[model samples]
Target: MQTTQFMITPASGKRLIAKALINYAPVQSALESGTLVIIAGTTNGYLAEEILSSIGQLEDFSREKFFRGIVLPPSQPRTENGRLFDESGFPGDVVIVDGKWKKGLTIFDVADDLVEGDIIFKGANALDVHKKKAAIYIGHPQGGTILASLRAVIGRRVRLIIPVGLEKRVSTDLDEIAMKLNSPGAHGPRLMPVVGEVFTEIEAIFCLTGAKAEMVAAGGVAGAEGSVWLAVSGVKQEVAVAQKLIKSLSREPLFSLPENE
Candidate 1:
């Protein structure tokens, strides 16, 4: 097995992540013409939003677009603070609200509207919905469940785009990583095994490690103490290429350490 390693302090993780994303051909292609990119994750939404906002390609569709032809959820009334909350069956580009968790939408809702040039950045559920139509699904290895479900639905169409920070990498094998991360008491829920099962079914896998988020308050990296991100895909050729890229990126540094002082 091959692996890639990146070593960065928390302060530089986010910037490295953004740079790594630019390396993906799918993302670069999608950015050519602003497309609707859906970002999903447990708590990484804020980071994803910030990244997209800095990219200068995000589109905030209003009710008019939803009513016209853009297939999105209805816009809810803005709050006193000008914030919009998610209501039942409400879909929009930007998810800026509070207390707005609903049953969630499926890929079928937006599959018909997805074009070959569109991009998607989502978690497991959203990936399951748009895997067939998505050029690439960007996130961690936990997204395997979505890939497995997508394979059942579309028989392998989407590719994987993984962006990771150096602090998240580990020397353990995939199974061990899954076990440690998904164990009942691990990270608040059982996610590792589920993600592990999905890894076996995907075609391509890309892993990037070298982004650290500086924790201004904690005086260190937010989750950089010991964390990593894994991403898998259902596209074989793409996965093979990604594996090679990961290896190339993981090569040992050529610098030498100084003598003991």
Candidate 2:
């Protein structure tokens, strides 16, 4: 097997993950004949772009304000729900039904309508890579979109796909962390361990190029913060494909909030 290494910044990783999902079995199947809810989040913003593009309806969609809540630096102001204080331009979640983009709808609008074979794409704040587990941070009084998605996921057999980056991978056990964060006196956003297929950059590489990718290192300076160094190994052709694929996304600009925000 031939091995190759590539440095993928968080933005590039999100793009890569989104590219992989463009041809994902579940997503393709859902788009053809079922419902697909792309919950509003930073990472899912990239995914919404890709999926929309795949269906030739990329026009009128912008990732700039495609998030409900986001994590910002200490200097930035946030609401109790961790969203920016000014939530005026917040776009609703991307809900696509039967290959049509249902504008102005969210999980709450269609959760009860989803049934078996449908899919939901939600981003995560933390991941347990070894166990393939993921969690979301919730500051809403009621559980957020996750709670609504769960009704279809665990209750009705709809699929939940989590497109998270390797940067969110955590060493601690998610269930244990959830326990602490959900304790009576716990302060701050609570963590909910979610059940879903955790799709990260590693999985993106394999899914797109048939190469196995292992995150060998992480972290960087300047625009490379939260970057992951991946060693992709496979047959000569596969590694070559992986290299080409990574190159196309290496220059993806860092995700930034709209200037008006």
Q: Best candidate per TM-score, number?
A: 2
Give the best candidate by lDDT: 2
Candidate 2, residues 238-258: lDDT per residue as tens digits? 999999999999899998876
Runs in model 1 deviating more than 4 A are 1-7, 33-36, 42-51, 54-119, 122-156, 176-188, 192-261
Clashes found in each candidate (C-alpha, N, C closer than 3 A): 16, 0
Error of 2 at 234 (Å): 0.1
Candidate 2 residues lying further than 4 Å off, grouped into runs, are 77-81
- How many clashes does the backbone of model 2 have? 0
What global local distance difference test value does model 2 have?
A: 0.91
